[model samples]
Target: MTRFAQAVAESTRSVPVPRRPDTGRTRVTWRQRLGRDRVLVLVALPGIASLVLFHYLPLLGNVIAFKDYVPYIGILESEWVGLANFAVIVNGDPLFLNALGNTVIITLLQVLVVFPAPIALALLLNSLMSERIKRVVQSVLYLPHFLSWVIVVAIFQYMLGDAGLLNNFMRDYDLGTVSIIGNPEAFKALVTGQVLWKDAGWATILFLAALARIDNTLYEASAVDGAGRARQLWHVTLPGLRSLIILLLILRLGDSLSVGFEQIVLQRETYGADAAEVLDTYVYYNGILAGEWGSSAAVGMVKGLVGLLLVLGANKLAHRFGERGIYQS
Candidate 1:
């Protein structure tokens, strides 16, 4: 016991003590940090400039919502109308109500069907044993995302219009022509289908990335335990993707009101306003085309406020469910 205590004392004496860090050290100034990271700051300037020019600057235009904005007159000279422009919404104008209803229907369809389509595609692609076949399928699916709305609409019209490919084939077989393109009854379904075709594959990129991040050991361990593919997927794969899915869902809710202005507007005339009109197109036709700028701006402001509320509510719900959501808040 005496020798052991002597040995311990010797070892303790030989070891050096760690010095305390200086809590009183001067803090690094912003200018010093900027100088140290000058190269990175230079690299980020273009993106910062773009945000200021395209995003921040345009927020000033929302002021037009409260003004009787006439492009001929300067903003300073335009008459301030306050909430007068919002009277259409309060009074329940038929055109505005129709646009709102159509927007809601389309948004619901997209959330129910289009949102999950990419995840399903990603799972199927991941299950493929052959890499070449998987790449070919992915390439084919992703091709439509590169096509413009004009080309997408044109392609759909060529394939499904009254006198187009389907109708032509049916005519030869003595089958009656089906009205798809200019049919108001099928317009919502048609547009939703078009959105799915154009974007589903591109959206799959996120799920595929999330899948790639999942550890292979989990699958291997599950296999060793005699767990089937279904069990492994349920236990391992979905848990890995849950966070990303939640994040995307929150973001989707934020932009739920915006359902593609250019795409819907192109078909609105053919299907009539009742079928294809959405909040975005409503704002464009009334504000820019018809020169009801204040009212249009008011509608836009309302849409933005609603989307903001949705994001905040969703983020709070995510917090309650023990998820990070889009931000800490």
Candidate 2:
């Protein structure tokens, strides 16, 4: 009986236990482990859905660029024109070059001038000892960001238009009125100033957050080493914020073509499209107004492709500089 029991035990040991059936709940277990991150996914769902619906889903409509798109006939019934629309937008449209040129120039100016101002402001605010004064300054600066483009344009018009505040002052003083807003030559500066006024404060928030994350110990150590305030800022503060600065710079570069649409559109008529028309306004005028949907869509598709390329290129460049771009390596 002992030998028989031993044999049975050995057989049982040799035999594998019947594998438990998978309940297909491995993904659920992983999601549960994520905990708070699951909430982020839930929160992100709406935005993801919106982008999928409005941005990416509309990619299907790029087919319209290859066809003679007509509202009555619809995209499905439209006659396929292949490269005709692309050719027209590329060669036939004179305004395309003008708008593209203006957009590039304006975008470059904003990147060089306006983008750095926020970082400088953030550094300045971070250096200040008085929190109350910093808060007050921040509040005043941030006010313009909330104002609509219409209101912003109106404010500019009120201050710089032909018979407006500046002109009125010029007349009173018997001095020549400066053409700041409406003049074609001054349009770039005007747009840059407007962007600085409206968005510079808001842009500082990220930089300030970066500044806050900097190690206080570094500053203290720098002081111990007999470093002055400026030296501390140069050695400790700027170096600490380098990663954030590069990341933001890459993002701005990725969006180089998208300087301002609404602001430019609002004043396009006043300045003549020559001064104010950008890629966005070009789409509106050429696509919507002229009913050249195919050509306009082609231009838009080109811009989208270019923007994607720019983002990828900028990300690569940022990584080359030993900084994480939009995504970490």
Candidate 3:
């Protein structure tokens, strides 16, 4: 602040501003409010109905975790088995444990690598002087996001498969080819890479929006104070993005357990269960394929509970750091 501005602020600190007289604001009734917002309500009815139908209504099926839920017997007719279904988790079944381990490993890898990819890309994009170039690059980067998981997996298989581009090129040059697709050790990394390739560009949208919202004057002020580009980014850009970063981190933690059902399952047979199995596939194989409905329900319920705990824990951590994470305290 300038000297005059500082003096003005200091003077205002001692001045007690007169309070406005209380004019009671008339309270609007629920019906009146509803009438005023009827158009908005109408517009929102489909989304509300969809949420109730798909998200909330399916919650009732968690009861299957406490029952010997046979599809033929139907949900209502299923025998009460109480905690029997959860024994798979409590007793630590070998397959379940393996799936859980794989899940943790993939989630951690994503947190380390996949999560920061968009932020880095956004920064790089923001540094570009040409708007045309930025738009073209962004379009190319996110084009893959619109492609289905099937297409993505197929593209990777074609490029990284045993007889694919890498091996073909290596053969022409007499260089040894490294196995990537269907390799047990590389499956986790492969999954993370695929996620980064597909979603990173799409994710950059929010960060770019956040960057646009930052005050241009802050950058000007930092420059006036002799701050270089890197210093301005560190001091001005990152601080502006901190809250959004925290909010995204909290959300990502909540859904961390689900690596990719369709993506992983497509390659699971080739990689084998030990290499590629995740919680989603575990539930699918046991429930739909093997008809262990109750056990699958138990596992799924546990997944959701764990996710809830992660969100709550991360939100609290954000609060401690004084950032509004996902919600207000």
Candidate 4:
């Protein structure tokens, strides 16, 4: 072999080999993850504990619905009574029936009338150019949400009670007094109005956040296409809010049966059980007050089951229309 050929071969052999980069992600073990994020895990422990204690732990007590629950006998020792407790509801106990009817009425009224109020209020607030005025209005509206049901009910009683502000004003003008507070006929309307006044502003916070997330370019583009404010809102704003609205609607339907325990309980005595009774109040009165634990548990279990079905049904409908509901299908 020639010396030049040997030299060329040797040079080629000395050329560096390209190395593959170590870019692969290492799999994390659960233990390692727990250790690495120990602080965060510790922070979340209270919430996890709360759910286990207040939510999941109570699920075990639901078996009392199928048993003749005697406090002395305790939960596990309670004699199994099959479906006897539920038969009270199915066989039409007058008190249970009255409570169920009132619950349905109040739930429907709140869902249909009060539910849409927040979205409308958010839209109205969004339309205002002045941030200061909007904030002031929001502060005023949101204040009521922080107030307890007791306080809200008290305020309503002061303003609308037979001998309160409204009646006092009527008397001064020699006008006839209106019977509003404790009036059975207007109980549903009063409850719905109270809910609106208390929570509508707070509910608007979610809607307003959704509104803020809507791209401004869409609004500008709509305007460029000669669309007016109404048209822009119809085409751009509503579509942007469609998902959030549907999600909230599904959630609301799930919770429709849970009208208001505190509010209803406070009013039940004044209005009489026949007038203001709802499922929650009925459960409380029967379980805690009357010691009919099994029957109350049965009613509560049925309510929860119905709520679950409503959420699932609504989510299914949402998916059928090619939209993501509460979760992915």
Q: Pick by TM-score: which candidate is best?
A: 3
Q: Model 3 over residues 1-329: C-alpha lDDT tens digits?
A: 99999999999987855554585565667898999999999999999999999999999999999999988879999999999999999999999999999999999999999899999999999999999999999999989999999999999999999899989999899998989987999999999999999999999999999999999999999999999999999999999999999999999888988998999999999899998999999999989899999999999999999999999999999999988888887
- Predicted candidate 2 versus true structure: per-residue lDDT over 9-73, tens digit per residue: 99999985654368533334555567848888889999999999999899999999999999898
Runs off by more than 4 Å, candidate 3: 1-24
Write down the TM-score of every candidate.
Answer: 0.90, 0.87, 0.92, 0.91
Q: What local distance difference test score does each model get?
A: 0.94, 0.87, 0.94, 0.93
Range of the 10 consecutive residues with the lowest summed lDDT in candidate 1: 16-25
The TM-score, computed over Cα atoms with residue i paired to residue i, of candidate 2 is: 0.87
Clashing pairs in 2: none
Query: Native-vs-model 1 lDDT?
Result: 0.94
Q: Which candidate model has the greater TM-score, 1 or 2?
A: 1
Cα lDDT, model 4, residue 126: 96
Evaluation by TM-score, superior candidate among 1 and 3: 3
* Alpha-carbon deviation at 302 in model 2, angstroms: 0.9
Clashing pairs in 3: none
Q: List the residue pairs that clash in candidate 4.
A: none
Candidate 4 Cα deviation (angstroms), residue 189: 0.5
